[model samples]
Target: MSDTTQAPAATGSTPASGRPAPRFPLPALIVMACTTFIGIVTETMPAGLLPQIAGGLRVSDGSAGQLVSAYAVGAVLGAIPAVMLTRGARRKPLLCLGLLGFLLANTATALAPDLPVALAVRFVAGAFSGLLWGMLAGYAIRITAPERAGRALAIAMTGIPLALAAGTPLGTWLGTTVGWRWAFAGTALFTAAILAGALIVVPDAPGQHAHTRIPLRKVLRIPGLATILAVVFGWLLAHNLLYTYIAPYLRQEHLDLTPDVALVIFGVAAIGGVWITGTLVDRMLRRLTLASLGLFIVAGVILLAAHGSTPLAILAIILWGLAFGGSATQLQTAAGAATGEHADAAISMVTTAFNLAIFAAGAVGAIIVDGVGAKSLPAVMTILAAVALIGVGFGRRAAFRTGR
Candidate 1:
C-alpha cells in the first residue's frame, strides 16, 4: 500500500525507536470501535429478542433464531470477496460505503413484515459487517506509525468486547422495553452517526497499490498465517460452544446462577481482559496469547468441576471472559504482523473463521444440548482450548513469534 501516515505532529507520540510518531488518531480509532460495536450489536441482538421477533414475524422461535444464522452466512460468504475486490479502494470511503449499507439494512430489518424479509436484510447487514471488519485492522495500521501498530490495533478492536459488555445488552433491553424493531432502528441511527464521523474525522488511507495486492492463493501461503487462523478457529469454536448456549448452560439442574447475572460477570471481566491486553500486547504478544489460551483451559476445567457451587461457576465465567475479551486484538495483531503488507487479506480470513465458528457453535451446541446435554459444553470447550493452546505453543517460530 502507498504510505498514508497521518501527521506526526498531531499527537506527538513517540516510539521506543526514538522517532516522532504520527498522531494517535483517537477520534478515528473510536469511530472504528463504534463501527464494530454497531456491527456486533446488529448481528447478536436478535438472540436476546427472539421471542418478540418470533411473535412479530409470526414464526416459531427456532425460525426466528435463523436470523442470526443468516447473518453469519452472509459474513462468511462476503468477507473474502468484498475485501479482495475493494483492495484498491480508498480506505475511508470504503468504510463509509459499508456504514451506509449497514444503515439501510438495519433500517429495513426494523420494518420488515415477515421472517424472510428480516432474514434477507439481516444477511445484508452481516455482509457489510464482514467488509468493515476485514478492513478495520489494516486501516488502523496504515494510519499509525509502524512502531505503534499494535497499540493502534488494540484501540481499534476495543469495540468487540464493548459490544458484548454493553451494546448488545442495551439493545436487548431497548428491544424488550419498547419493541424489537426499535433495537434495530437504534442500530441504524448509530450507524448514521458513525458514517458522518467517518466522513469528517477519519483520515483517508490509500488502499494497496494494485501491484502489491496478493492473490488469494499466494496470500494463503504466507508463513504462520494458517497457524494463526487455526487458533482463531478452534479458540472461538470453544468459546461460542458455551457462549451461544449460556442460558441453557446456566439453567442446568445443578447450577444456581442466572444467565443475566453470569453474563454481567463475564462482561465486566472481559473489559478487564481488554484493558490488560491493551496495556501489554505490544510487548508480550506471544505471552499474552499463551496466557489467554491457558486461562480458557482453566476456566473450562473449573466449569467441569463446579457441580452446584455458584462461586465456582462464577469463577469459571470470569476466567472465560478474561481469556476471550481481547482475543480479536491479539489474533488480529498477529495476523497483520505475520502477513506484512497483505494484512487485509489475512484479516478477511480471520473474519471468515470467526463467523464460521459462530455458525458452527450454534449447530454443535444444539446437538450437544439435545443429546449429551448443556453440561457437556465445558468439556468440549476444554478440549478445543487445549488444541488451540498446543497450536500456539508449537507455532511460535512463525505464528506467535516472540519479540513483538
Candidate 2:
C-alpha cells in the first residue's frame, strides 16, 4: 500500500520538506495505555485481595491464587489464535471488541459464585488480555511514523509500570475495604470509558491486504523474529524469577524491608527508565537494549554481594526495575521492525513468549525456592541476564538493529 493508504487521522506521515510531522497523538495513545492499565490491574488485583477472594468464594488461599495462574495460562494460549483469526479485521473495531470482551469477563469474575466459576472468568479475561497485547505493537507502529514508532510504543505501554506500581495496590485496597467484587467492577467502569475514548479518537486502519498476508508459520520463519523472541523469553524469565517471588527473596535476605516498599521503589525507578528509553530508543535501540540487560546483571550482582544491607537491597531493586521498564517496548519494536508487514504476527509471537516467561518464572522459581532457596534466585537471575545479553549482542545485525 502507498502512503495514501495509511490512516489519515492516525498516521504520523512525513511532512513536506522542512516541515515537522504533526504532534504526537497523545489522546489516542492514552486510550491505548489505559487499556493496558485496566488489563493489568484486573489480572493482578486478585493477588492482593486473595484473602477476600478466597473467603468470598469459599476456597483456600492456594486455590484462590490460581486465579492469577489461570489468567496467565489463558493469555499464553489465547494470543496466537486471536491474532491469526483477526488479522484481516479493521483495527479500531477489533480493539473495541477485545475491550468489550475483557470488560465482560472481568465483570463475570467479580460476580462468580464459586472458585471454578471465578477461575473460568479469569481465564477468559486473560484471553482478552492476550488479544489486546497482541495488537499493541502493530497498533503503535500503524498509528505513528517510523521514527516515532518506538516512542509511540513506549507511550502506549506507559500503563504497565503505573499499573504495577500504583493501580494494583489501590485496587487491592479498594477490594479489601469494600469488597473484591467492587474492585473488578471499578476496573470495568474504567474499561468502559477507555473503550468510548478509543471509539472516538483512535483512527481506523485497514487490515493487511489479502495478497500480502502470510501464514503464521512463515511469519515465524522471518529472519530476526526468532532471535528477538528468544531474547524476550530469556530476559523476561530472569525478571519473573525474581519478580514473582520477590517477597521470598526479600525475606531470605533478612533485610528490614517490606515487599510493598521495595516494589514501590522499583516502580518509581521504572518510570525514569521508561522516560530514558522513550527519549533515545529510535536512535539507540540496540545500545539501549544491551545497556538494560547489562544493568540487570549488575543489579543481580549487587543483591548477591550485599548480604542483608537494606540500603543496598533497595538500590538493587531500583536498578532491576529500571532494567525491566523498557523491555516490552524495546522487544516489541524490534519484532515489528524485523517483520515489517508481518508485524502483527510477529507481535503475537512476542506476546506469547512474554506470557510463557511469566508462567515459567512462577514454576521454576518455585523449584529454586524449594530446592536451593531464595538466595540462589539472584545468582540464577544473573546467569539468565547474561544469556539474554549475549542474545542481544549476537542479534544486533538481525533483530536488534542499530536504528529505527
By lDDT, the best candidate is 1
- The local lDDT score (0 to 100) that residue 356 gets in candidate 1 is 87
Candidate 2 lDDT by residue in tens digits, 1-404: 11112233445555666566756777888898898888889888988998999999888999999999999989999999999888888889988998999889878887888999988888888899899999977887787766677888898888899899899989988998999999999888888888999999998877777888898999999988889999999999999998889899889889898988887788888877888888767767888899999999999999999799999998899999898898888888788878888898889999999999988998999999999999999999999999989998888667887543
Tens digits of per-residue lDDT for model 1 on 1-404? Answer: 11121223435666668876666788999899888888888888999999999999999999999998899889999999999999999999999999999999999999999999988888888888889999999999899776567777878888877888888899999999999999899899999999999999999999989989878989989999999999999999999999989888888846888887788788888888888887777667888899999998999999999987899999999999998888988899888878888999999999999988887898899999999999899999999999999998987777888653
> What residue runs in model 1 are displaced by over 4 Å at the alpha carbon?
1-19
lDDT to native, each model:
0.88, 0.86
Cα-lDDT of candidate 1 = 0.88
TM-score of each: 0.94, 0.95
How many pairs of residues collide in each model? 0, 0
TM-score (C-alpha, index-matched) for candidate 2: 0.95
Provide the lowest-lDDT 10-residue window in model 2: 1-10
